[model samples]
Target: MIRIVLADDQAVVRDGLSMLLGAADDLDVVATASDGSAAVDAVVRWTPDVALVDLRMPGLDGAQVTAEVGRQAPDVRVLILTTYADDDAVLPALRAGAAGYLTKDTTGEALCSAIRTVAAGGSVLDAAVQQRLVALVGPPVPAPEPDIPDGLTTREVDTLRLVAQGLSNQQVATRLVVSEATVKTHVNHLISKLAVDGRPALVAWAWRHGVVH
Candidate 1:
């Protein structure tokens, strides 16, 4: 079963989300929070597989809760739930290590599926969110980008592009015709050179600076 914790200042929203998720056979709404700090505390205590968060909560907010949870328990993936998809909320949420973002209006089915996807180490970039990522990232400019970093081989660049295209680690290895271990090595090297900690950062960096193109 996928354990979940929900954090939203609004009681109605929390109740709705909890009921929606609880109806799923494979999902358990272990707890719910009315504030960001409580969300952070619950995440550390229960260590849910995923957290559904509201970006505008009074204390700490979604970004801070996500960051704190990531620092204290990185295994608990964060999924931001906001009323709007604006950059004001989206970019900061992603930077804080949230695995996905969803608006309040999403269907029960979609929300449940997103939880499953994020729990399995995948992001749910809604169509609007995908465009937001590209827009906020600006554009590609390869010139003078990280010196192509000393350790990255030509094959690694191909691999990086695939990653920027949203492929999982296993998918990257298969696409590059190499073992997962090889892909892990390349990815580790890339992160060290670029100084990024997660896929969202790597993707934004590669897309914005033309590193992967």
Candidate 2:
């Protein structure tokens, strides 16, 4: 089972999430906290696989809690579950070591899946949150140099740019006027050529290498 520590200031939200997560056979709510400090305490005390945290709470807030958990219990993955998806809220949590970001509007199934993904050392960004991040970063503007790095094909470069912009594979496919499977193929090629572990690393690599501005 994937052990979880749920943290939300609202009692109703905490109760709802507890019930929702309790329904999953592979998920168990090992602890719950009503504030950011308590959330950090719970995570440190229980060392759950994932900490489902709210964006705003008294004492520390989600980002602070994430940072604390990273410091106190490095094995715990922090997943931000909040009502706000704006840049101000999303960016800090990510910067502070959150492995996933999902708005409260996410379906219970998706929430559980995100928890599992985070616990498994994967990152999860809600579709809406991804769009917000993409918009905040803006579209890619290629550098003036003509030669591509790593001998990447023009199509692979295109895929890398879109992926760096935080577009999902399906969204990238639609933007490129290609099939989703084709986009996935391009992504796989990019991952291999760029030597990145996954999509999140791809985004970081793109920014670091100026693949996307």
Candidate 3:
């Protein structure tokens, strides 16, 4: 089972998400916190496999919790579960070593999938959020091939195509018969070459320019 920690200030949201997620057979909501500081405490105490944190909590906030988790509980994967999906918060969260991010508007199934994805050592940034990052960083360059994108290794392109299709890293790894770490390297490389700062950007650029076929 995937062990998880929930950290959002809203009682209704926390309760709803906890109930929804806990119902999944493969998931376990090991602990819940109302804010960032409590999230940190939960990490130190419970050491769950995944932490779903809100970006705007009192005291510590999502980014700070992510950073602390990175330092103090290196084994734990942090996934930002927030309402905002703009660059102002995205960069800091990623820089803090958050493995993935998703909007609070995400469906419960999607949110559960994101937690599992992060726990399995894969990225789970929402596609819309990814586009926002690209807009903030710079304009996306149209791929030369339209159909035949470049800059990434052929394998990297394949990995990105799967990502665009909304497959998790674990799913991609299983499909490709490669390790998840290898898929992650391909993803990072794809992000660098496309100048698409995040998953949403990649999806937008690929759809607009026809990179994935």
Candidate 1 vs candidate 2: which has greater lDDT?
2
List RMSD in Å for every model shown.
3.4, 6.0, 3.8
Q: Order of all candidates by lDDT, from best down to worst?
A: 2, 1, 3
Across 76-111, the per-residue lDDT of candidate 3 in tens digits comes to 999997787874777788768888888888888888
Residues 1-213, candidate 1, lDDT per residue (tens digit)? 999999999998898888888899999999999999999999999999999888998889898998899899998999998887765778888888898888777888988988898898776656466557767867666576543556678887777788777676677878888997788778777777779766666777777766544
Highest lDDT against the true fold, candidate? 2
Preferred candidate (lDDT higher): 2 or 3? 2
Question: lDDT (0-100) at residue 160 of candidate 2?
Answer: 82
Each model's C-alpha lDDT? 0.81, 0.82, 0.81
Ranking by TM-score: 3, 1, 2
> Model 1, poorest ten-residue lDDT window?
140-149
> Largest TM-score belongs to which candidate?
3
TM-score of each: 0.78, 0.73, 0.78
TM-score (C-alpha) between model 1 and the true structure: 0.78
Better of 1 and 2 by TM-score: 1
